[model samples]
Target: MVFIRWFLGKCILLINALTLPKPMLRIKADQDKVDKKTQFFTLYQFEACPFCVKVRRFIRKNSLKIDLKDAKNNMANKSELVNNGGKHKVPCLKIEKLNEKTMWLYESDAIIAFLAKETELS
Candidate 1:
């Protein structure tokens, strides 16, 4: 019984490692679409998520001024993201619109591209 349980646990771990879920990407806001006067974009992410890392690096490299939220810790922010984006994924971009509404965006590639184009850092 013990061996069987251990084997099952190992299998679960292996599956999680091998089949890591892909990030979600929705809503692409262009540079011209966003206002430059906005203080900073907000990012919701975890420490271990690679997708989050990519966005952070790009924002840092380009010297973007944005707020950071740790999804693993903050329930309010996390719930807001999940409610708005419909998924609890890291590396989500929150763009503040001219109307004072927050926009949620996912996917590493698209986020990087949008930030690059918006900040003229690409």
Candidate 2:
């Protein structure tokens, strides 16, 4: 059962890699805006997670530059997710606002929507 699950996960990852969407063209003004918005955002994810793949695809398709933190093998990142976010959830996004306030966002759909809305202004 473990082997089957691992194999299926690998297959899903392979499919995702093979069908990556082309990134959107970023205009100078839009890029600048996006850069600012993404500068403080970090995405915590595991490489093989389907939800993470969805969020990653959205980031790539929209040409967003948010930093990705791999929590699978990285102890520090994993701990950060648990300690700060209150749980070690894949596809969690850490958003830091200009006011020095931090927001830990979970769930892939909500993260994608928030990112899309933020970038739409650019």
CA lDDT, every model vs. true structure: 0.69, 0.92
Tell me the tens digit of each residue's lDDT in model 2 across 1-122: 98997898899899998999999897798788888879989999999889999999999998999999999899999999999999988899999998777999999999999998887871
lDDT of 1 by residue, 1-122 (tens): 97886676566556555755553232345333332533667888875466776676666555556788888778998898898877998788888867676778889898887776666522
Model 1 bad stretches (over 4 Å):
1-40
True-structure lDDT of candidate 2: 0.92
* RMSD, every candidate, angstroms: 9.9, 1.1
* Ten-residue stretch with the least lDDT total in model 2: 113-122
Per-model TM values vs. the true structure = 0.63, 0.94
Winner by lDDT: 2
